[model samples]
Target: MPAVTVDNILTLPRIETPALTAVDRPVRTVTTAPTGYEGEGFPVHRAFAGIDMGALDPFIHMDQMGEINYAPGEPKGTPWHPHRGFETVTYMIDGIMEHQDSNGGGGTIGGGDTQWMTAGGGILHIETPPEHLVMSGGLFHGVQLWVNLPRSDKMAAPRYQDITGNKVALLSSQDGGALVRVIAGEVAAHQGPGSTYTPIALSHTTIAPGASLTLPWNPEYNALVYVLAGQGTVGVERRPIRSGQTVVFGKGDTLTVAAADTQDSRSQSLEVFVMGGKPLREPVAMAGPFVMNTRAEVIEAFEDFQAGRLGSIPAAHESL
Candidate 1:
């Protein structure tokens, strides 16, 4: 049985149109900290990696992983782990990733593909590089985001969705200078392939030099943009941003991204991941791999994992 409750999943508000008259929202805050390595030695840059879970409610963690190139036989990846009360979204920009879970779910996602896994009640899963890739190492680049589930659906059954690049909704600027890939919400009247427990707009946008694109967004949602590559300006304020930087937006129904106008700029294109979601506005209790509304529930989750009630992945199903 699914762990998600009907009320929690069904009541999520959908934004079919802008709630406020379109206005160019300005950049509110910018975050850029040093990158670090985690998850079995993988290099990562995190967004809101701190402990204050409520600050990014409904969006717990975001890790931009491994833009590093590995020599032959030097690849590294994560081992098996358990999780609950949230969803894990892995979006690959380059290279490949293999995944195996307790529920007999296993697959490989390559460049431009995505895996959205819901660890509602609980599940043990492993995400790693492919065996061949480990043998003959290459480049690896991807991002993993943890989206929190509502209190009422914390114990819902787990699920998974593997979305290939072609399956994602794609939109482009009128002059073909910008492209947007809708991963978990609607863009240009097209919805993403993955089903979401909460209302969220997640997109991978790319823009060429001297180009600009405006996106309509939900006024009530908290919005943020993380620059993946190149330099660009965001919002009406034209807040300048570069790779490895994150820009938080203020209240408004529209935002703009403009690539550096100079043709001789170091970067030819600007790539970013745009994300926004409604805040849960509820207390959060989180431990390693577990998230809940209260400390008691978090304790119970750990107990369940220790008791093997969360299920375990078969060793044979996991790849290096």
Candidate 2:
């Protein structure tokens, strides 16, 4: 949960409270994420499961990758894979991950770091734990979100951005009871470091017990709040929610969430991942690894990948 924190949260910039006339978004649906395994057998929570694709437009998928503590020699990661028509945003809250892609974009990201890879057109990449982390074993927690590219930019050139924790814009709730770490897009006039093809806002927020936060949101963008840990309530109606749950919000100018007065010992506060994006409103056709506008295009992507048009594993990483 230590994605980013300050010694005194009161010192951070405060998010202005919404005007009394502002519309508070109502909760549309609250779904619980099912536990699963991803990559090389690492645990994950399918954060987007059961949500409608239309509701998640511009956001294809997401996975909450473990709040688990691994033992020595138990770390796992994804094998080399090809992706197209989308961007993969991997944000590490704890532990370390090394990434290498065919387009000559690669890096090591640790706690509070992010690796944003745009697999536009096509690209091959692999994510794995560093050798030392594998040998020593430790806590690993992170989130990977797939952002869809508009049809016009689906075939654009690939790109990468490495965003360190220090680059994230940090802000406090009006009452200083919450810490908001903006990873991408703008929040109350402050922008995050990661660039995005789709207009979106992503933040990790920690709310102290019994505290409430009201966030200004784009009226045109769809809003969602995913609870990563602890218990809380969302919307003005005060719907109860807890870890592994995601709250989809209806149209509005503001979003509200309040932590429970008491939490389990395992989690001292309520941690949530908030996101919203302008709807793409385009037809979506997706295969195992490729997201496209048509099924035929998805088949073509697989063909190209198998034909070596996507990319090859770097010589140095061939052994991995």
| lDDT (Cα atoms) of all candidates against the true structure | 0.80, 0.94
Q: Which residues of candidate 1, in runs, are more than 4 Å off?
A: 1-21, 50-55, 262-267, 315-320
Name the candidate that leads on lDDT.
2
Query: Which residue pairs collide in model 2, if any?
Result: none
Across 148-182, the per-residue lDDT of candidate 1 in tens digits comes to: 99888888899889888878776666666777778
What's the count of clashing pairs in each model shown? 4, 0
Q: What TM value does model 1 have?
A: 0.89
Model 2's TM-score against the true structure: 0.99
TM-score, per-candidate, Cα-based: 0.89, 0.99
Q: Evaluate residue 11 in candidate 1 and report its C-alpha lDDT on the 0 to 100 scale.
A: 38
